[model samples]
Target: MTDILGYRAKFGVLGPSTNTTVQPEMDEMRPAGVTNHYSRIIVDNANALSDETFLKGTALIDQGTVDAVRGVMTCAPDYLVMGMSAITFYGGAKGAEQWQSNIEEVAGVKSFIGSVSVVEAFKAIGGIKKVAFLSPYYPVANTEVRNFLSDYGFETVADHPFRAPTWTAIAEITHKQVREVVEQMNDDNVDAILQVGTNLCMARLAGRLEQELNKPVVAINTATYWHALRANGITDKVSGFGRLLEEL
Candidate 1:
């Protein structure tokens, strides 16, 4: 018996409880008949003034991920899309692969990770190598993102770190701030620019930025959702989220 609403596919989206942006943003990218089931990883107080506290918060999210996966799996989703990126970026290229492998092993379905998904987006868009990215993460997490991208042969030309005070605060960052960072990261040398941190919500902004910047501006939420759709053989081109969803 096929699911009535989710007859195309049911995607299990894993994000942190504090993230307020994933649901609405991913939902906007959702194609007809494709439903997104979000399973939030519990993180009560994701406040951080130092690297330790930031990592501590992420540790809580990390620990809670397996349960989140199991919870989403109960819905019998055909695929899983990671709406959180920090843990997935940990341990570099091989680490990301192992991380995704573990999630897929437990989920009993193919999972799309932000880190891997962004890389795939690069490949799909083509002509992307030297990339700059902005993230609402501590310097430590930024390092992991840099390492992960480097392992995939994408040289990190530059990066801008927001270091949002708390997990919830990441969503509070203004579009102007993000646009300025993208402008700062953009130059003749950079091939593309990307925004990490799913809660930061750059899906809509990215599409507009691509037109303004005249360069690829990938948003994690958009890439992960696109990966989930394409990996599952759902090829409906979603516009207004950037070229990866529309053109690619």
Candidate 2:
């Protein structure tokens, strides 16, 4: 046995190999005593997203995900995180629960997926019924997310996606552009503003946007990390994100 029980507060993240935003977001959200590691799976390069592309990447994704967690399992991280939101949102509510259980079984450690963490954060903030969303994916990916959330019993009141073709473009998007997309999602009837793209740089602005919008504005990355920290009972107050993690 590697004896993972004796190490410090380390976390392992399973993310897309090309993802450029998950680490920065994790760094911003993690508290003083914690650290992070990453495992990358195949992802669309920069041109397009297609079923063929996803199919080609499936074996790589599965292998990389297992390898990432297994490698980190040596260090015995207290927790594991699935850093991609789309995969987390797959299979809906039933899928989310099974994924959590599967990760724990394979990793021999507690685990969380970004989408599940987002839902847990919503519950923590006492949000139910309805919410709005902003995404940086094409219509196909957008439909997947919508269906996942609806299956979880959350009404998708309204949503706007920028229809980006690749994850790299989503990560390369500037903060100013993200804020503009945020403006496009403004609605009076939605209970909150939810974003689901780890590639999107909405974490740093979560606090200010929530205050300005007068409702919870949850960046997917932020909520995921918040849920991880909370799941481990680590309650260090993280500022600059939003009231969800700061004042909750």
List the candidates' TM-scores in order. Answer: 0.98, 0.88
Pairs of colliding residues, candidate 2 = 207-241
Candidate 1 at residue 174, lDDT? 94
lDDT of every model, 2 decimals: 0.91, 0.76
| Candidate 2 worst ten-residue window by lDDT | 51-60
Q: State the weakest 10-residue window (summed lDDT) of model 1.
A: 43-52
For residues 1-248, what per-residue lDDT tens digits would candidate 2 score against the true structure? 33343234688877877788898888777777688877666544644566444434433554567766787788667788777776667678787788678778999888878788878888888856688888776556567678888887888877877665665777877778877877776777778888887877788787788888888888888888888888787888888999767976
lDDT string, candidate 1, 104-199, tens digits: 899999889999999999999999989999999989999999999999899998998899999999999999999889888899999999899999
Candidate No. with top TM-score: 1
Residue runs of model 1 more than 4 Å from their true location after superposition: none
> What residue pairs clash in candidate 1, if any at all?
none
